[model samples]
Target: MSHADAGPDDDHPHEECGVIGVWNVADAAALTALGLHALQHRGQEATGIVTFDGARFHSHRGLGLVGDNFSDARVIARLPGTRAIGHNRYATTGETILRNVQPLFADFEFGGLAVGHNGNLTNAQALRRALVRRGCLFQSTTDSEVFIHLIAISLYSSITDRLIDALKQVSGAYSLVALSDQALYGVRDPLGVRPLILGRIGGGPGGWVLASETCALEIVGAEFVRDIEPGEIVVINDAGVHSIKPFSRQNSRFCVFEYIYFARPDSVMDGMAVYEARKRIGAELARESRVPADVIVPVPDSGVPAAMGYALESGIEFELGIIRNHYIGRTFIEPTDQIRNLGVKLKHSANRGVLAGKRVVLVDDSIVRGTTSRKIVEMVRAAGAAEVHMRISSPPTTHSCFYGIDTPERDQLLAAHHDLAQMTELIGADSLAFISLDGLYRALGKPGRDPASPAYCDACFTGSYPIALSDHDAAPERQLSLLASAP
Candidate 1:
């Protein structure tokens, strides 16, 4: 099958986007690019940066990897500024077009402002219609543009007030990094469903940094100061970093999947080390589901850390049964069915020596559609494995995520439709199991998920949506009006 036909959620959920803002730092644009490189795994389709050189806003956006676009010194030089914000975009809303690429900049009644967002706005379509009716012309189809339009139409004077006004009208998860001539701003949604951290660039009264993850700060030589609290707005400028809580405090529902798969293994989020959490999850999984296995084999890369934890906890030997080809790009072309059938091998190859005559337990982060898992299992069987049992680090992803994660429709989700036995048969594994929700909570240092107010956003697993999906849940007539009003 063609890659397009395979769809975006073949096996794993895709990250929505990553944002970074740098203020009062030398070579700010270059540092932003480096931070983008660190966050490259979050989004690969497009990259952009907008800089305020104290005079005019300079922007350069490209439709490829950061290295492919921003590697040239000339490109960095073209974006000269002391304050800047950048984005790595894996489009969840608009089509992957140059115009949709961000740090989307706009000139308002006050001054030029640029914004990079890391979550989806559930009410974007509804808000867009109202804005359009009010004669607000949209330059791009991205939901991120909704903020720009709202800012432009705000009756408030200050940029911060205008932003607060725009935020009040919206509902959904978001972590934003905005740049203005006056200051660099970072704000998290009331739920704080996505991540945004504050950091210091140097010692004493040094510069400031804002990014989607702490790892970005490390790359730019910035020390992570603290996580931007839920419902908090942090304004960073020459004077110092200031905080504003525009929204009332609510229970934080940070995306739980970030620890399981979406985030880089090394990155820390919400004060939890992702790698350590994954290991703890694997340990929990081992305790909950122990099977007769000769060796533990990770699916590779994503599965490695958890597999190690499982091995340590279960007293099973860990082996690299599947070796991945890191050099393979997403755009690898397959001109013939013969080559296309070798799809899994193009990215992964079975280590025959490790799998031969062994009862192997395959540990993976999560299963989205079971397509990749089936293929990997088949490859292991072909390589002389006696048996293959699959274990997942996260619970069954039965519901689609509307926040910022790229998930298939509810109908396309494997766990949403099938029972455990059926899923095992479909994936051609001897047995299959996933960590329980409580087990996951334990791994994260929680006793168990309190149904009243869970510690994190486990919507994808429990179907307990934290935010109202306005666009998705609109009445048929309202949805029609939204479509009809589209430009």
Candidate 2:
């Protein structure tokens, strides 16, 4: 089922998109679909794939899961090509209409180019306004459409140069995969705020893969090559792969939340294993906030790894105090108000045998609006929990994300408005604790976050945005013009 149907208590920050591209592989569209299935966790609202054969380009986009859209053999057969690019969309920037489903393709003087982007642009609105003023008609409301318009109007001679020219005028975090007649292109934003990894389909001189995570590489039987460096672009063609660094080098501010929650546990990014990083974060949380309890209970799914780590570190027993139902679908009928109120139970149910008459420590990744946290806490208490202690693996998410994550506005965030005690009381917990920011860094193998130049983007916790929110700031009175330089 989709996130929208995951019950009323499904309150976690959402990743906006995931992108994958394949070059030199036979039935590349099918492989691209497999990679998208692996990245389905990143975004589930929509999926699309664009393929280029020797003759022409083909595309198929739908407003649902990748399997629902691409599992049919007929669909794959229709997209006959040796190169392909795909996108999984969750719609943080645009409506979930068919047009917004991406791998957005366009015809230009140079050739046809299909682009799949995995991050948000901070200045897209302003740029779109300028483009409209210059008589450029827009087809979609997505910020990603700005890239097409910019490239369409570029003064460069070659497609590569035109793309570089277009990138120079935008501000935001992005891991982009664009397919052209000449080659398959992958690019990461200057600050490296998102993830992009390179892989080889086989051994030496084989088909190449560019995806949002290493798990996608694994799913396609590809060998992990290396992470695409921030501010670098790689072009894959018949001859070989070529690299270009169009922007000045800068320290990366990769999104820290990816390790904490956004990425799949099996995935790896920036040389760190996501599952191991999460377990370490859990151990750090246990060390920082040790509370005596009979058992440690995870919120389930995302919280499972951290709970295991916390149990080991705290010397507490771990049990399946919460069981999740994987078969629940969006079409489940809520015939009455009572059934509607039981939505949380449709996806999650408290294991009374494990929780009854026990002091439970509920380990979860993070608390967003606290509605889900409250519901889960109440369910445990109702199951006869002696005392409920909540421990969060990450620091309080105090601010909204503007770089591809779907977070509530600042005011709606629970931590943004409440103190620890207030939050605990509101969530019906005996106590609550979150891992310190320094502890989180330590878990990631750092001494501590250097305020002068932090190792990762902890902007959601500190409200210190690494990239300027050009569009957000300009929305009030339109005081600033579009920023043409990378942040």
Candidate 3:
């Protein structure tokens, strides 16, 4: 569907994209398809794959979950190749539309290039303006397209050199995989604000795989090698892997939310366990915000681990007070204001038998707009909850995210709009509390220092972007011009 047709309620925020690239494989497209399935949680709106068959590039793209998009055997059979790249996108930057579905391919002077990207580009506006001035036409509003044009017009002779030069100019959290006829190239931004990993399968003449998460590797029967180091470019071809360090290495600032909420519990990011980290956050919440309660009820799915931790630490009974509707897909229609108002209730229903006459501690991952949280509180109270105390596992979101996450603009964040006391009243909760920055870090197993710093990118909470953003008010023309002339 076109972006203009999508309504606001249909445009829910999602994390960045998940990318998978495979080289010299007999079943590259199938391998990539499986990898995309494993990384589905990272993105759900659309999926695409571009494959290089010894002679030509074949591609398939559609707007929907990976499974739904590839359900047609004819669609999958059309894409035949030995090398391929796939993308599952969640629309962090641009609108969610078929035109923006990625594994974006371009027929440049050198041949064909397919790129799948994760993370937002901070200088996209400036870069797009620059590119536009040079007569570069853009089909999509996503920042990822800028990189394609940058590589297209570079002065360098080879694709690798042009890609390296193009990357040096753009800034922000990115873990990119680019496919040419002969090789697959993987790059992580200077600060490593996003996660990417490399893996291999089989023995003699084995192929290489690059994915946003290690879980993707496991799905494709590839053994994890290690994470792609920050600022490193890895090229995998028939001659074997080669590496280049174009940008200077800085302190790695992997997004902390990956551990707290975004990633699958079984997935390991930056040498840390996601499930364990979340459980620790729950325990820390109990230690710090000890509100008397009879039962600890998790918000469901993401909130379960933290709730378990809270219940264990507080010696409270853990009850499943909220039950989520598993059948609901991401793109549900809420055509009216009343339906929008009942959005949370449609997805989650309070178990009256469990919550009735009980003082409950409701645990959730984070509160962004606070609308959902408020509605959930009201639902629980309506179900006869005697008192509800809301506990957030992570710190309040105070700033906008320039990375892949689709957090609202600064003023829209509930924490930015109200103080703790005001938010408590607004959500109709007996009390409200968020885990401190230290508690968050401690939960992630990085205690004794700042939880929001040194190791993790907490820019959404601290307003300290690792990369400098271009002027926020830059004109559209100016922004497009910068993109064209990038590098």
How far off is residue 332 in model 2, in Å? 2.6
Candidate 3 Cα outliers beyond 4 Å, as residue runs: 1-13, 330-333, 448-453, 471-487
lDDT (tens digit, per residue) of candidate 1 on 356-462: 99999999999988888899999999999999999999999888888988988767879988999999999999999999999999999999999999999998898
TM-score, per-candidate, Cα-based: 0.95, 0.96, 0.92
lDDT of 2: 0.90
- Candidate 3 residue lDDT tens string, 1-487: 1111123532223577899999877777888899999988888778999999988999998887788877677777888887999999987667988779998999999999999999988788888989999999999988999999999889999999999989987987899999998789999988888889889965658589999888898888888888899899999999988999988767888888887778777787877777877888899999999998899999877889899999999999999999987655424635677767666766788899999999999998888888778888999999999999999988888776767787776668787768899989988999999998877877777754453446778876666666776645255764464343232
Q: Ten residues in a row with the worst lDDT in model 3?
A: 1-10
Work out how many backbone clashes candidate 1 has: 0
lDDT of 2 at 123: 94
lDDT by residue (117-232, candidate 2, tens digit) is 99999999999999999999988889999999999999989999999999999999999999999999999999899999999995546599999999899889998989999999
* Model 3 TM-score, 2 decimals: 0.92
Which candidate model has the greater TM-score, 1 or 3?
Answer: 1
| lDDT for each candidate structure | 0.89, 0.90, 0.83
lDDT comparison, 2 vs 3, better candidate: 2
